[model samples]
Target: MRCKILIATDFSKAAASAADYALQMACLCRMNLAIVHIYSVVLPMVADGTMIFQDSLYDLAEADSLERLSALAAKLNLDADRLCGDGFKPFIEIFSAIGVPAAGIKSFFNRKDMGMIVMGIKPEERYAETLPGSTIRKLIKWASVPVLLVPMDFPPVPLRQIVFTSDFADSEIIALDFLAGIASAYHSDLLIFHNRISMEKGRLFLLKEKKFLDKVAQEIDYPKVFYRHKQKDTLEEALSVMEKNSEADMLAMVHKKHSIIGELFGGDKTLRMISRTQVPMIIFPQSFADIPGPARLGQNQLHD
Candidate 1:
């Protein structure tokens, strides 16, 4: 998995915050970074032929977008690959409308061995939605590699300490070495965490997860590693664990198909977990390996 870092931008100030965080992460990983902006002009209902064709506005947006990206690259002191692509629909739909920002990013970095993607999450604070963009959610769940999400207002700093959430999706994980290697690359302190509930089944599941981790520790020698299994059941309670630790620079998790807890709990649980984390979070797709399920892997109530 050798890929350069890719950061997509929209000239919004919130996006600028994400871009800054990406640069710091890129420098830490020492991976070549490519900053891209996908621009499109939507044809709104114009009463009459007020001006030029809708497509024409793309040029101005493109120019402004480029200037913004350039300024970011310069500020970061990074010589990154910069691009501005054209699309017919809004930027959010460009991915499914045709190819995607992910595909282009994959291909562009493929020649140079593109392997992972890092994107900005968090709504423009004014929007007040805690969820990520539909595009980002799709990519996080579907991307071939890891997609790291940075908060729109994350502080500028290095990603030296990482928290990898362990939901115990499987009895054994074959990728311990892979995870260890990546953690070692960044010289990061790997904090493995687990959230538990009072439910008997959930407790049993956590025990199995602990057993799996113990086996991994015995098999491979991972450095500077620590593990914490929280007895909290609610998402808010799980967040309290993060607040207690308060040392991770990023959050990492495997996107399980049927979270042992159910899709809604497994998924929303992570989102709520993210809500408490000040650092960026990276969701690793479950296809990578078999992990233990949480509590009710395939069952989720509307209230998850």
Candidate 2:
């Protein structure tokens, strides 16, 4: 009945790992967890007396999916009283849908008012990169909420340190408000990381970036803030180094077109950085940051 964290799973090793990670996070935050599995229904070709066979097959598939879902929730201690039959089902909600994965996820979020969405990414092997699949890409593009991508092999760990990549865009302060709420929810420290390219005409860029962050400091009231600025050659290299050196449990970024992420999502460097990330990454779209609700902290208006 509390704020829910929706986790998409396919019962694969990677998805199960993501589910476990979500469970741990939900328990830590004292939030409810919703596990969803999307399955496709295939119809059989018409044949004499085959209608019965088709009906049986359909029933079998649904039953198998439900059984697997119940079994999965049992590990979390949800009994039949809470879910179904004799098992652990009360503590969590499991849904099986026969439709597009992204659409189902979106509908679930709207219905439940989910706090966040967690899904696993099976990083592509081409060029030895960790590129996300089309499903994840679509979900990130269309979902109106924060999407957390857990690498296939990510280990379970306490979310103690969270890093946010800042581009000094006007909407970034709005995004930071959401990120700060998450940091507070988990009792985690926040690190604002900025990687500066040397191509900026002289030192003016650094001065401008500094002044922007100073303005950020004045408007935000979060304690335990760490600011990191690095002069780097490429975005991929800088992000890889941060993951290596920061030991952060999660990374947060805003998805603004014409921003660094826009370039990363379009360029070859996306795979390079995705391959190197050792932690989960949470992306907030521009629309999500613009949502007008409790997150609309009435801070003094932001100015350049």
Candidate 3:
């Protein structure tokens, strides 16, 4: 996944902020970058002779988009050689990316070997609380590549601190392992936060997770280290508890294929959290292959 990065452009401040972050990340990570702007139109034609007029309109729109792309390319100071263009209409389908721009972006990222996708989460007058815009959330839902969602108005940081939630028992710490790997590479603090459900139950869950984490610790040490954010034992209180202490760069999660299904079908807290995430998140699918030999953790043992 080493292809040039893609930053979805809308020419808005929020979109430009995302572009700025992409440029900074590119320089820091030594990754190549691409700026993609998508324009879609629905043309209604009355007579067969209207084909010529519709073609002209399409060409004009495309030319305008390309001109904007060219201006952005210059503003970003990207050498003309590194700039590229990708244009498609309502007709093309990749990974079922029809009618949905986010799907198309995700499909593009996957097929291009792109390591990451970046976009802006637009802001509103309500700044204290932030939300991932509709399209951005859709991409988050679909993309496997790492994504950075810059807030329209929020400031960027070195991302020195990050928080990832885990009941600890969900899968293995494999999810945590991946996050820790990235956070470590950035020298960022890793905070594992999970709600404490009940006095005793939450405590026990904590203990259970800590035990698994210890096993993971044996496998890999974080001298830059780890912290357990014990929040109120209920979902309602969880975020408040975590927020009480400090802020984190990202809230990471795993789409334990089963967990995702349960959240969507079982209507659990994971679903609740998804609908009301205050921070941007990074989601990962479990792995490449599952063997039929045996089962490691029962679903009951893993529900968050």
Candidate 4:
């Protein structure tokens, strides 16, 4: 069974770019695609205690939202032939909801068929203000599926090299297991990156790194996996070095509640990276291991 990728759009230029990226990914990965637009209906403050036009207002808003979604879907369908080539065309669906964006998106998670959620982030200057209390942050925080964030004007290229930041946690392993599918499909190299502040050039640190690599080797069967270690004073500095050196097509990370990513979201560094990075990013939520899907193989089946 092919999984579906849910894309959230507000009809902005950034959102449109994200939709295009998702379309290409769906075709390449042989997954279904869905586009959703959420609109809010704000009613005027009436003098009377009761309002008679609430239902009509909601209906109109929903109608407009659906119409826009349809238009976007049509545009994407036109490019399906070019992207799919001789492969099977992915099934595309469009939907509209009336309420908050985060709540509307969470409703689709109940379907249990979604493998990922894709959204677009504006450029750096706008990202800081756009993230706090925004729908993107809410989804990143609580969504059960992996969230793929595409920066505006990001080049739509095949994913050849992916950089995954890790702390050698169990959740990071689970996230790697899930990402292996895409890496295999794209024939991409998976680079496991770890950064430490300690400048100890001793055998103990070297042994620790070797142990982590050995564990990954025993766990993940992918042959193209590699590891990279760096010494840096801060996460931001480490990220800068990784971004500049790796030349990766995408960045992947696991977001645990108490992890560095979780703490970064509370501040501005992660937001800056999200806005400044030229490549797309895939964030695996803390609950990724619990999500039921073919992409998330069980521990018993992982080695198979």
Candidate 5:
């Protein structure tokens, strides 16, 4: 079976933008894109007691979703009828279920070759403000595949440079190494970005971290991998400054239990770091690098 990039949409503006972004990425990579919308049928009860199956209702809803999906593909100038055995064209798949949204998403991943999950969110101007709540949070935590969070306002630019923020953790290096697809597909330059804490012991820790990053670069030995860093009062502030300096096409981070990801998403500063780049952010699970795939195989070769 052919693999595809799964883009979840709710037909909202944010979702629409995500679909568009996924379409562009899929086209660039010469991969197939599947836009999935999961909906549950709600049938109104009559006074008599019995409820009808209402097949027509579901049919109408499915038709409407397909129509909208077609419109989205049309906007991308993708021909839906053209079938490439590898799923190179854009297609729509509607999953109707009477269960948790996350469960439906998980089911798809279990049965499909899901390269990545791309979701869109509304961009906030301030990071400290109240954050919007949605099923995306649930999906991010539950998904086995990498998740790319694309802000609705972000433009689809060439992914020429990808900046991965590292805390000098081994898991972070593994996560970066796992993303060989994005790098090889775009031929992107990899930036091993780290930020030092100002209040912490200055030169010693700085030298230690620089050496750690250098070791990582040497281990990977990718010609395009480069190291960069900055010292700031806070991790969030340092990330913001680095984003400005790098003009990175994509931002990546490794999410682990009790890591900075937990703190960032748990507090009001979730949007602070996210808003700074306005670029697509890819989140890799700390333990997910071993999964079999071209990317993982490439990482193994690099290690050898």
Candidate 6:
């Protein structure tokens, strides 16, 4: 069976755009699609702290969620012919669950053989106060597979160049290996960007950069790979400059728990970056490399 790309949608404009983006990716990667809708039924509590059992409300919620999911699947199927030419239609599935959005998604994800999770973020979510409770933030923090975030306004374009931010950590090699598979699929350039503070520049930094590139060359056999090193006062500054210079179609990075990107959901600077970044971003969890070889690529392996 082919691997599936799970799309979490709330039926909003942004969610629809994300679904479209995932559809394009699925066609390119020869993968299937599973669209999920997570809903919740809030129960009323009595003064004694007892909750009222509302079977009717629960049933209504489930029914509505299923109806919406079906509609979404139909829409995607209609677009498949136009987006995926030559009658190469991808198999599409729909699912619904009742609970917290993130928890519901995690439960479904754990049971499926999915390669990636794609979700859309609204422009308002870029605000600092709103980032903490955003579902995308929670998914990025915990999802084992890559989480691709598409800004609501981001147009779906062919990925020609993917800019990956790296810190030259050991785990980056594994991340790069995984990304090389994607680059190979699109025949895109994988630009490894290393951002350092201005003070860290000089011969020692150059040596470390050279060593990292050498290791990449030895380990990753992809010929279209390239590297760039830049110094700025902050990661956000470096990212701004890279965005202007790289002309990248997509941005990728591994989320280390202690790294700035990992703290993106909480940090002020990182939140700002998310708010202003226009390109789609794919964030790999720190432990993504730990998954078995087959599972990492969403091949013929069952995830326990």
Clashes of each: 17, 6, 1, 0, 0, 0
TM-score of 6: 0.86
lDDT of 3 by residue, 196-280 (tens): 5555465676578678678767754565547565547565366645555557666666544434455446444433444444554
Candidate with top lDDT is 6
Error of 4 at 35 (Å): 1.4
lDDT of 1 by residue, 44-151 (tens): 676775776655666666676667666766755532222211211111111111135555455442333444566666554214325445566556555555566777
* Candidate 6 per-residue C-alpha lDDT over 1-304 given as tens digits, one digit per residue, 9 for 90 to 100: 6667899999899898899999888776767899999998977656886666699889989999999999988988888888889845789999998888998888766654777889887867766434533677678767878888888867778888888888887778877886787777678899998777766678998888888889999998789999887777766677777678756788888875655554654454434555667778888888887876443663222121
For candidate 5, the C-alpha RMSD (Å) to the true structure equals: 4.9
lDDT of 1 at 182: 55
Name model 4 segments beyond 4 Å from true: 44-52, 124-133, 199-204, 258-272, 295-304
Worst 10 residues of 2 by lDDT: 295-304
Residue 58 lDDT in model 3?
A: 75
Stretches of candidate 6 off by over 4 Å are 43-53, 128-132, 258-272, 298-304
TM-score of every candidate relative to the true structure: 0.69, 0.80, 0.68, 0.86, 0.76, 0.86
Residues 149-251, candidate 2: write the lDDT tens digits. Answer: 7888787676688888887776777767656766765778888888776665467886877787887788767786678877787766677776787657898
Query: Where does candidate 5 stray beyond 4 Å?
Result: 44-55, 70-99, 123-129, 198-211, 218-221, 258-277, 294-304
RMSD each, Å: 10.0, 6.1, 9.0, 3.7, 4.9, 4.1
TM match of model 5 to true structure: 0.76
| Superior candidate under lDDT, 4 versus 5 | 4
Total colliding residue pairs, candidate 4: 0
Report the Cα lDDT for residue 215, model 5: 69
Looking at model 3, residue 254 earns an lDDT score of 51
lDDT of 2 at 67: 85
Q: Report every candidate's CA lDDT.
A: 0.55, 0.69, 0.55, 0.76, 0.64, 0.77
Q: What is candidate 2's TM-score against the reference?
A: 0.80
Displacement of the residue 34 alpha carbon in candidate 6, Å = 1.0
